[model samples]
Target: MMMLNIDDSGMARPYLRENIVFNHAHTEISTGTTLFACQFDGGVVIGADSRTSSGTYVVNRVTDKLTPLAKGIFCCRSGSAADTQKVADIVRYQLDFHRMQMDRDPTVLEAAVACRSICYAYRDDLTVGLFVAGWDESLGGQIYSIPLGGMLLRQPAVTGGSGSTYIYGYFDREFRSGMTKEECAKFVSTGVALAINRDGSSGGCVRLAIISKDGVERRLIKGDCVPRFSIC
Candidate 1:
């Protein structure tokens, strides 16, 4: 039942009672990160900013957002840190078991599907999104974006998180098919740096993972080394 209060003006104002139910998961929690994956000619490059925030405060300055799910597959995470970390942990365990049973590395699509299954199951309880990128013998390289609510899309280039909103136009103009490895890396790094400069919730160093048939190479571009552009 609702409680009503009469003010000096004699107007009744209804208020929720103590017994009313509220879903905390639906509450807004400010989260920040810049994540993106670009599929180049021979492989894929995934990158993310290191800033982790809660509301207006910066919590972690050097958190790694790129998580390894399989032999050559990795995911870029954004959203609640605990939620994304737990989801990645579960997906990694399942993929490891699948690989052992099949005596081969799990495919990129298989890994992405595993993530989607978990994310979909907890869609209402979790606020997380992932970009799955990897290289396999069958498919040279692939990039799959599994956003909130578990919707999956395969794209040549994709970006996410708060910082992404500032770089949509940048990607549209710079991204192209058949890009070389160096070109792709530069594109990813530049785009992320741009986001960090503009997004208050996104800052810190840029972490990158370049995946190909050879293996995965990790790179850390310090904040000082990140490119800056004048927005004025």
Candidate 2:
């Protein structure tokens, strides 16, 4: 009689256990769409569409993706709503604790590293993408894109989610060096609006966060605020 052995591939030489059991893995597919940020002359402009979807279903129409992770830093969440919120809370808590302990605020890069550490720890289990935008005394203003596993990329302009494919061209054509804060804000708003128009997964009102040397400003760009025609 020949002996059969099963390897890592789960294949047997001939006969395997008829009762072999396969473990089931639970996957929760939740995501949001259309988040982008850009740097202007003196500040950074971050914007996102307020749409949350679970697989094919629209879970919420009014969701805020842009959140303040630290006193001067803002982040946009794009995947797994619950995971995003929970990660944001964790990052915020860590930032707060760091500030309290050091008696100083964390720079956007430092904050990114901190958040990335947390994301790295859960790289295998969590699905989350983030963009960190803020003003730094040393670095001026910047935006850092954080993908799964906490890989961080400093970008002058970036977009995440399915809608990113549609808006990158628009952003490339409209974005330029040394744009004013207002110009950056308009560009972000228009890019998000265009995403909502084309990407079925992206819709609802546009939210904006302007982080500058002075402070951070939040506003909602309503329908009328979006230009009827291209503003570029």
Candidate 3:
């Protein structure tokens, strides 16, 4: 017969053996990420720090958290890596079919809506927070934040993940209403780098996706290349 144990949260979970002790700390895997997206004059820039962890152990130090959904649309993933990746994969497949049927590229809003739908549907079971950013003929550049509960938000700039808490103040002070492409990319990279430095679970290289009317540009900034930040 199977054994059921009531955890501290009062949830019943299956266990193999009565003698075995379960430690939630060692079993949970988390993507301690630093993800952000910002809009510029021509397009949008999305960036993330590359780190995946299980408890205190670093599982993947160089994992890419920025996933490309369509031609110009990309999502920065945080929370449970498996859940987020699966959501992205499902959304990408849907977008591809939508494009073929419509005979046109999917809009950024369409992609964001798809994400929100999936997230909201599985909100009770899934733990995911994503920043979807891209460029379309209609909107030029767009940024959307899909938080844990599947709340979709349209914003000029958005940040999330464990490291995000460290840089909220920085973004508030540094972010501007309008910025050039180069300026926006710099702002995103700097903010991610700062978060990587401050958050222990967030480290590794910084990955960026810059989408514009022209096309998408990918940039990888190594740890050494990251700009130094010091508070006096």
Candidate 4:
């Protein structure tokens, strides 16, 4: 149940990792990678390549990268598995609290704030990187990203990871705002193509999810993929 962690003063805190053992539902180990999220005029498009690394070598290839929170929001992670699930758990609990207290689903902004707060709870060692996408009618499909230990950040869109710089470069050149769902999907396809190509740790499959008012629209896995989406 213990993993290595150096505290602020370069002191080891075995308890931080040991405190939450895998025996209980409190922990789940995960390794992840480049996730794509785009919000368009109609809804949201989220794409995550199935690649994971334990160290420098590929460890998993057919991983599910995106998880829907509700009718309009989704979350993705690309870091330590234990930390990411803890962050997700925070989201689940907070949403429940808000739904009962405020009488509405937590807004994307509110969710971002909550997630980022979770990231900071680790201070420095257990930080999490998140890509959040959803429908903010006023913004009409929005993309926002948070860095490790980040606070409230409002971006039109974002990408994260050791390969983030490369993904962002692709996004800057390829991402199109105010797009329709079709255009957004196309844009996401292009982004995934770039990530899988440049990020050695990303590949095997892609789980694509689209979000709208009605609900989330999921795409076929690689084998069942239709034309371009399955090209990998």
lDDT of 1 by residue, 1-232 (tens): 7678776799887764653445544544434789978998889999999987766567678888898989999999988888998899999999999989999989999999999999999999998989999999988899999999999889999999989999999999999998999899999999999999999988999999999999999999998888889947
User: On a 0 to 100 scale, what is the lDDT of residue 184 in model 4?
Assistant: 76
Question: Which lDDT value does model 3 have at 226?
Answer: 78
CA lDDT scores, all candidates in order? 0.89, 0.84, 0.91, 0.69
Q: By the TM-score metric, which is better: model 1 or model 4?
A: 1
Better of 2 and 4 by lDDT: 2
Task: Compose the digit string of candidate 3's lDDT tens values, residues 1-232.
Answer: 8778788899888875773565645666888799989999889999999989987778888999989999899988999988999999999999999999999999999999999999999999999998888999998999999999999999999889999999999899999978988989889999999999899989989999889999999999987787767877
After superposing candidate 4 on the true structure, give the runs of residues whose Cα lies further than 4 Å from its correct spot.
Answer: 1-32, 136-140, 221-232
TM-scores of the models, in the order given: 0.86, 0.83, 0.87, 0.75
Q: Sorted on TM-score, highest at the top, how do the candidates line up?
A: 3, 1, 2, 4
Across residues 1-232, which tens digit of lDDT does each residue of candidate 2 receive?
8577686888766555763443322335455589889998788999998887766567777788888988779989988888888999998999999999999988999888877887888989888999988998989898989898879889998889878888788977887888888888888898999988888888878999999989989989774565444456
Pick the TM-score winner: 3
Candidate 4: worst-modelled 10 consecutive residues by lDDT: 223-232
Please list all clashing residue pairs in model 1, or write none if there are none. Answer: none
lDDT score, residue 151, model 4? 59
**How many times do residue backbones clash in model 3?**
0
Q: Candidate 3: misplaced stretches above 4 Å? A: 1-26
